[model samples]
Target: MIELREHERKTLLIVERLDGKASVEQVINESGLSDAAVMRAALTLQEKKLVKMKEKKQTIAKLNKEGKLYAERQLPERRILDVLYKMGGEALLSNIPKEVDISSNAVSVALGWLVKKNWAVINQKKGTIALVESLLTQKPKKGADEKLLELLAEKDTVVIEELDKNPQQAVATLKRRKLVETKEKSTYELELTKKGWKLVKKGLEVAEEVTLLTPELIITKKWRETKLRKFDVTASGPAVYPGKVHPLQQIIQRAREIFLEMGFTEIRGPLVETAFWNFDALFQPQDHPAREMMDTFYLA
Candidate 1:
């Protein structure tokens, strides 16, 4: 006969009910044990040669915050394509940045995907983007990347294997765009040994664990019937790192406070300032390279 703790016995019973094999998620749901408790019990069972833990590493796809926003609002590339179709199937490259209402930085990304899908083509000399007649007239369809994003939005995360088709290429495309991120996680499944199965088949019961002693229980003389909860004072619990502001932000705040105390006022400048303020106000040379188009951002 082997010695078993209350939690170990409970965990074994749940695993036995699951046909001798179950994932940690399944065990947690069925056994009603906290994650730490279940993991501790699994380790104890493994040491006793009662259960073997098998781990499978799987790549899962999940949408980031930006992806969620994109899912709600159609992708920038799709929006660009829609606007191009409405505007006689062609538009100047410069007009697209303002017309599509998408960030100027994303224009190139949208154009690249538009060309890749054969939905549109860019005329470098004319600085215009035109639809591919052969593809535009046939029909509009969502690409694999867009489809994957919609699916991920519905389900926060999905295993690569669960994808319908062309998972590798589809994931590669989304990964490149940074719309979705992939994480490798180990999924653990516990298998019961012959000895464990036999032991669990004998049946088990949930132990009574009381959290508090009440005066009513003592008055009713039911103290002997109550089982107190077990606590391991020697075992270290989880570490906690309290929330704190970023070091850089703290330093900036302190500097701001010091300046105010010294009767100094801070003035903020607009991000997009004309050359008049940037160059003329500072008495900078107009012919300086820093004032050139290559070195400066000009507001249209």
Candidate 2:
């Protein structure tokens, strides 16, 4: 959705031809463009945010899991003494910036400070978290999920792989219990025994609802729950029209309008589709330089 310069646009075409990724020479050779022109095009592509450069070199990112665990721990020795009960803590240390964008040294220092206050403990070997006396890590106890798994144990379930990724654990647990048996392959293979449905129903009742919100939560509907809900009519909606849609939507709409005005019919499809429609139909081939998720749609 980023805008591009003429040079960048050319580079984009070349990169698309290469499947969203290409080396410097590849862009030049494929575009039939000069070397300098290609380099300038590539730079322009990067400037407009349509392209990102990975310098054929190894890149290392740090992750600070320990820091995260530790920070989730509590504070203030006086306040801690007043509390009757305690529960779960936050992240631990050894998390580098790559993991959660935190510095390991800073995290370590903070933990040390906490330890001095008798607020937290540090044990690198066990990856230990100082959970409070009330802490309990509980997974859902939905026996219903187990039943769905039992039905799915049949050989011929169509969406087996999906179930595995999304609901496999319950399935495996049910199968292990021997409540439902796999009898056949193909054509809706398994039959759910009385036990299976019962398990699934039980699971549905006990399922927990977890919510995570971020500042940019508006990007997804599910994320909206993370924001503070306001019922005060005094804090109403915008009084005057902002006269703006999301920037990406606005730009894309303008582009479509321009193209329509120029007598080009708009082509509409999902961002998730086969590579053929996204690239080949657009005059790009397997070797094209520009076929990449950043520059184009990700087929998967």
Candidate 3:
């Protein structure tokens, strides 16, 4: 259950966007990864079982329901927290109404309190009110697991594209605890773990595998190394490039320097300007397309 690195996650996302049908070249291009780097990450993901090979030509990283939920909570818009200093084991969703600043839809979904869109429990003691549900329990997914089992049983190798889960992340939560092993003489394959078989076959679900990052760990210099993301959704500024300036601008500056060195003052003109200059100054007809605002910015 090792969490993937940030760069590894980027590569995985590229493969997912390729629609479970990308060559390594396509992955490298979209991910802005070098050929060597992309290959290395792909092999790592496959070995870790976060990604599975569909064909010899394509690779796809898959995420279960747990993975999707984890990633979703990490996003700025969906993220929330509470200071539960009193309640050690259990709490109520009704208490969340005043503590959290999100829509009720988001609160209900995150709490796992609703069964058939109904709150599992509602209690009133004195003037205080509380609602309770098994927060660690799995939210009922409509045929999501059945679909996965049917697909897996049909094919020896799965692309993970048709999976209802977020098939783009390497999750620490759902990493195979015990890999499937072959009982054959010549070859070996992934054998289901005791935990895995029970989950897939029986209608039983274990607790959620959410990892809580410690406050001390979050203060670490590179906390993201521990798969904890720090977000300031409230931070103000335009989008960032996160690196140095553009290479095209650098080339232009160099050209500017080269022109100055050649004892020539640089002058700029449009590639296709108005007919007032393009044709009128050059002694041509006035009814040119260059005079139109669609092709040129008119002074009117």
Candidate 4:
């Protein structure tokens, strides 16, 4: 005769009906309970030694906006391959930009993947790319990357586990293309303990009495028969963070305010300027570390 909360009882019934093992997602769908409620019930059951919760952390891969667009139109590499095939399976590397609709930024990306796939060979001296036998024979086929692209095109998002192909290979390739992002989260699976089975065999019953002493129950003199939920004074409450200005911004603003209060004039510098104006004019040595190409950004 184990006493149970309404939510805990609901969870147990759902799990028992589910053949003693089910994912939190399945329980949520079958039990029609919110995710938080299901998790809370599961936690409570675990504490009572009636059920065990096992967590499997998985990394879910999802396509971004640009990925969706590329999936719809095909990857730049695939398109470039098509362009090369149309040119009799060979073309000057420079001619690809002229023949294909791919952007300048994407040309290198497409070429890199194309060469990496061994679909084409670059002749540095002649600046020409020679396609392999597969492309020339019209027998080259779509691999994991192409399949993933097609799958993503039809769906807004897909977990890596749902893929019918090599998930790791697909995720790795798409990640290099900057087409997908991964997020890791723990997925919980609930299982009944021996005690839980014993309790179930003993016939657990749902408590008909309400836990809250509502105003209606009090007015109707039903509060005497209803069970009031016990409050845990030691339980932690939700954290509170008072909003404030960003730390760096606040510091800059305070510095400006102090300068103004001291009768000082504030000056601004050009964010974008020629090297001569930014360095030479300031008498900064040309060999200074900050003048190195890696240290500064140059607008193209």
Top candidate when judged by TM-score against the true structure: 4
> Against the correct fold, how does model 4 do in TM-score?
0.71
- Candidate 3 lDDT over 74-183, as tens digits, reads 31112322222234323455766556555687665544423322423334453232223443343323233323333333453354433435422211112431111112
Regions more than 4 Å wrong, model 3:
53-300
TM-scores, all candidates, are 0.68, 0.19, 0.20, 0.71
- Model 3 residue 245 CA deviation (Å) reads 51
Preferred candidate (lDDT higher): 1 or 2: 1
lDDT of 4 by residue, 1-300 (tens): 567887788889888889999899998998788999899999999999999999998877778888888887888888888888788888988888888787888998888888888888888999998788766887468878878877767775677765665867888888877899888888999999999988887777656547567799979998877766656799999999899789999999999999999999988878898999889999999899998879989887
Residue lDDT tens for model 2, 114-217: 45544455567766435333332432132443335334333324233444444555444334434333333221111222433333334322122233356555
| Candidate 1 RMSD to the real structure | 15.3
- For candidate 1, the clash count comes to 0
Total colliding residue pairs, candidate 2: 44
- Candidates 3 and 4: which is better by lDDT? 4
126: Cα error in model 4, Å: 2.4
lDDT against true structure, model 1: 0.85
Best by lDDT: 1
RMSD for all candidates, in order, please.
Answer: 15.3, 34.2, 24.3, 12.8
RMSD (Cα, Å) of model 3: 24.3
